[model samples]
Target chain A: MIYRIRTIAALTIREAARRRLLAALVGITVAMVGLSAWGFDRLAHGGALTSGESTLALPQSLILFMFMFSFVVALSASAIASPSVASEIESGVLMTVVTRPIRRGEVIIGKWLGLAALLAGYAAAVSVLEMGVVDWVSGYLPPNPVLTTVYLFAEGLLLLTLALLLSTRMSTLAAGVVGIALFGAAWLAGVVGFLGTTFGIGALRTIGRISRVVLPTDGLWHGAIYYLEPPSLLRAHSLGQNENPFFTRSPPSWVYLAWVGVWFVAVLGAAILSFDRREI
Target chain B: MWQASSAESDGLVAAGGVPQATAPGEGAATTGSPRPSVSPAIHTLGLHKRYRRTVAVKSLSVSVGRGEIFGFLGPNGAGKTTVIKMLLGLVKPTAGEAMVLGAPVGDRRTRRRIGYLPEMFRFQPWLTAAEVLRLHCRLLELPRPSWEQSISESLETVGLAERAGDRVAGFSKGMQQRLGLGVALLGGPALVFLDEPTSALDPVGRHHVRQITRDLRERGVTVFLNTHLLAEAEQLCDRVAVLDKGAVVASGSLSELLGRHSRVRLKLSAAPAGWTTGLSAFGAWRTEGEWTTVEGVDPDAIADLVNLIVAGGGRVEAVIPEHQNLEERFLELLQEK
Candidate 1:
């Protein structure tokens, strides 16, 4: 059984590595990384800012680029993970393998491990590259670079797991679209709730809290941002009215971290259950 | 030898086909009995399945003896694939019990001893043919030491040895189908369920599949074949079960099924005035332009009829015996139903 699961994992990874879409993704990633590097170089050498503002602007600008990169991660993970299970089920590619002596749980776990490994590699590469570019241009690095990279990978994984669960019952296209849409909505609600909290608007704050409970994707992204920005920048954003969507007032609480873990497991468990009952 | 290894794992097969642990030697002991009657390789009791309101299969009971090539014949929407799926544990039965090699349906250990090729399926196109076989070898838990040789032999058997290194993405539909067959034969399974194994193949590929299936049977492997091509079934099946709307309408050995509708066409140089009338006593007779057609004639009575013709002073020139082929019998069965 262990051998079977391992073989499946290896095949899954091998197949994923060969996808044309993955090549396209890497191409776009390279272009984005190069473009960001150029943009930061210009900001440093173009002489557009005072030294005092540059201190705050450097981290601010880096966080903004990080937001785009994180969204890209979420999108890429959904694109791959959504079709990994749902399309196979629809196309009947899963029939032969599942009929073997291996358990269904093994298949699910093997697939998850394969895709997670791929996404983890992607997240780490982009985060590290962007950090290097930032340091070269502005001599500024986030206080906790490793923590920020970990958080970004966690955010991508959370969305990927949700997409996988949806794929068990929905079409691949539907799962991908819905997964990304929920991720976007949660982030929007989090921003609106931050404004509500800053201005003491009770109803708006409630909406943000509710969205976080419904989907923790935005919460995870917020944690990544909290680690990526300097403490001085965070304090500045807090003292002023919360105008920046990328700014984090406080680190994610332990209870929130616990909830994220619970949510991830619950979604993965539900996916396995749905896949078990599903008829090909 | 393969049976012994499989049966050595546990107790006697559970009586009702529900999966349970078996004593290691009970399988061998039960099979070794001299009673002449033994457990079927594939057996189902009132198996049924429904997709919402669509009744895919209903009350399907069948038994395929060991080492026999059992063809499952059915038209479109006749539930042939559904039955195969249920037996292979790919689809759950709605309300009946099924057992394969005396193990309950979907039994993990039993699956190790079984091979299946679905009616419609696709392999991961990125993997080479050799890699696909390797993956299945691991899944089937074939001995690690023999993996390399087993993969090579399976590929060679399917006429795919030279293309083993080629990625499946470059394969034609027929080649892919052949690869699917190779995958099914990977572990030297005790029983193989082939659903439309020849659907995408050209004549040559189909012939190879038939030969492979026959070879498996010769080696004491039970083959449960599902196909719509009547001639294929007629040529290969030892016994057959015809399914219609999820039910077995007719089933028996090929000879038995065809025997009931046998006919003979006789051509004579000349006939006596009352010869047609006299021929009626031997069997049902009708006169076509240059022949006397005998319907439902017994094989032994053919000689007697020819001798009678000579006694009646008529010269018998030709006697052509025709047994109903599967197509005709299948049509008649459908019409009767």
Candidate 2:
């Protein structure tokens, strides 16, 4: 079983590469990173500001860039992993593979591992490159770059798990659409919660808490935001910057992180079970 | 209940039209010595499946002995694929028991000895032919050292050895089919289920598939084949079962079915009055001048028929066996259902 799962994982990764999904994601990321580096150079040396002034501006702007990358990661993860299981079942590939000695759970786990690795690798590489360029241009790096990237990778895998679960019982397009929509909804609720915290409203705060518990993308995304805080943002928040949507107040608690882990395992288990019971 | 009908099918396989299979391992059991009995490669008792109001398979009880080419014939929407899926553990049967390779269906260990080629015959298009085979080698858990050799031999057997390096995206329909066969042939499984293995192939490809199937049988591998091409089944199958409305309508050895439905034509030179009435004991008879055509008797009974005529003071000029076409026989059986 171990050998079978490893083989399946390797084959899936090879499939993603062969289909050029990995290449496309990498290409778009490189273009984005290059553009960001050029923008940072202009801000620092193109008469817009001094290096010190630009470094001061880097925190919020860097958060914005990371936010964009998060969206890219989420979308890519949804599109790629959503179709992995559903399309194979649709095209009759599952019919052939499952007849072997391998179990259905192995296919699900293998696909999950393969896709998780791809999305995580993409998320980490792009985060590191973007942060590196910002650091090179202005000597300003996020205080917790590694944790931020890890959170970002976790966010992508979270969406991937949900999308893969939906794929077990739905069409590829349906699963992707539903996954992206939920991500949007969760993030919106998180913003609402942030507003509630700013205005001392308990109902909206509870809504955010419930939404995050329901689906942890926004919760994890907020943690990524918290970790991506540059020293300038930290000083500003220390002097009171709680009203900013980009300014997360603190890292996710152990309870929320535990919930995310539980949610991931549960959804993945459901996907495997659904696939095992499916007639195809 | 499972092995009752499978290990011994004397009750399920009554005389006449209902299919009767050879006892499992009867072929290898040399006469005068106790037979080394091996479980049938596939056994199902009252296997049934239903989806809401749709009944896919109903009471599909059949047994396939080892090393035999058993053809599963059915029309579209007759649940042929469903039965195959159930037997392969891809889909669970609603009710009944199925054993493959001496264990219940869906046994992962037992699956190591079984191979299946689905009707769709799809493989990962991104993988090369050799990569596809190697992936299955890993899935089947074949020895790591034998992976390359197995891929080479399987590709050569399926006539895709030269294209082993090409990705499936570039393969033609015929090439894909041969590659599918190559994938199925990996690991040297004890039993293989081939669903329309030749559906996408041309004449030469079909012939090649036939030869490969025969060779597998020669190697003591049981092949459960599902095909719409009756002509192909006629040429390849050792025994067959025809399914209609998700039930076994007719099944038996190819020769038994063809012979049982054959028309025995006899030309008489002498005479006994009302000899045509005696034909009723055999089957319906039609007389044309001195020639009489008899239908629906075992072909082996033709000799007894000749003796009857000779004892009745009638001289027999000729006895010719005109076996019915399997295609026609299947059509008649389905229409009867």
Candidate 3:
């Protein structure tokens, strides 16, 4: 059983590699990392700022960069996974595969594992490389880098699961559009909730909370943003208010994390069930 | 060895008028007793499918014995593909039951022993031919030690041994079809379902598929073939079922279906003007000039026909016997339906 799944995952990875999509993703991500590193170096050495000021502000800048990285990861997950099954089925590629001794659920889980592994690995490596660059250039490193990467990876997995679920029932383009649109809506709601908390508006706060509960991408992004804040900003943000979208005041509650876990399983299960019932 | 018809194979065959094929060594053991396994390779009773109000298939019943080449014939909307899908468990049957390889269709163990080449014959374009074979080997749960040999043998069988390292994107439609056939033949499946197995092939490729199918039958493997090429079916099938409009319009061993209506064309001189009148007992006869044509003459009674004409005060000039080929019978059946 494990052999079949491992072989399928390996095949998926090989397909991605041979198609050069992996290469394109790597190239674009590397260029982004290089440009960000240069910008950080300019902030430290070429900008009008004292050493202490640059040090204090650089982690906030890194948080902003990390936010961009998180978006990139979410988008990648949607693009890579949304069409994975739907297109194969549409083209009759899965005809021979499903008729084999393997079950439909195995195919879905194996593909999910392949994409999750690729996306999570990409998220972790990019986060570490960007943090190291920030620390080297401006001498400012965020606390809990490992925890921050975990959140980003989980966020990618979450989006990937949604994309996969949609792939079972929709076309590649439709699934990707819906997946990414939901992610954007959740993030916008999170920002609105932050503003609502600052202005004492209850309705916007409820919308944000409900969106996070429904999708969890924004909630996971908040956890990642919280871990990227420097201690100084955390103090100031707490004193003033949670007015910024790039930095957060506290980590997500364990209950919310637990709910995210449940949500992950429910969506993955639905994907399997939907694919199982679908006439291929 | 080609009988031009399979009707005689029915007496020995125990399922749906298709004779059972003993395995390589089972013939020796069969002299003293019945074959150990009596289950037909495929057995279906009242199978059906529906998409909303549209009925894709209905009241489909068929039986195929082990080691026989069963041809499934049909028109464009005849539900042939749907039947194959239901038998392979790719589509859910709305009603009735079908058993394949001694178990229910879509059963895991049964599927493991089955191979399928779908009509489209597509694969991931990025993978090489050899990689595709290897992927199937793993999917088939073959041992690690056997994977290399199995992949090599399959590639060799499909004549893709030289192109095994090439990506599928570089393959032509014919090559992709050969590759699909090679994949279906892998793991030595006991039953293989081939849908339009030669639709994209050239003469050489079609010949290769025919040879491979014959080889599969010799190994006591049951093959269920679906093709629009009636000539190919005439040359390959032991028994055939003609489907039209989601139902089996005609079915039996080829000889049983085709042999019942064979034709005989005759040329005679010095025959009486009414000599052909009593020929109705022989068959449906038509006379034009010196020629008299008869249809539906049984192969066994053709000699009686010539004797009757000779006794009717005619000097027989020439007697030409023409058996109704599958294409003719297929068209006739469709037109009648």
Best by DockQ: 2
B63-87: candidate 1 lDDT, tens digit per residue = 6778889888989889999888888
lDDT value, candidate 2, whole model = 0.83
Stretches of candidate 3 off by over 4 Å are A50-56, B1-36, B270-287, B297-316
Alpha carbon lDDT at A25, candidate 1: 72
TM-score of chain B of each: 0.82, 0.83, 0.86
Model 3, B118-166: lDDT tens digits are 9974899988999899889889998889999999999999999999999
Clashing residue pairs, candidate 1? B10-B22, B10-B23, B10-B24, B11-B22, B11-B23
lDDT of each: 0.82, 0.83, 0.84
The TM-score ranking, best first, is 3, 1, 2
Instruction: Write down the DockQ of candidate 1.
Output: 0.76
* Model with the higher DockQ, candidate 1 or 3: 1
> Taking the tens digit of each residue's C-alpha lDDT, what string does model 2 give over B6-58?
44443224112233334334422322242314557777767889989988888
* Ten-residue region with minimum lDDT total, candidate 1 chain B: B7-16
Interface RMSD per candidate: 1.1, 1.0, 0.9
Would you estimate the TM-scores of all the predictions? 0.90, 0.89, 0.90
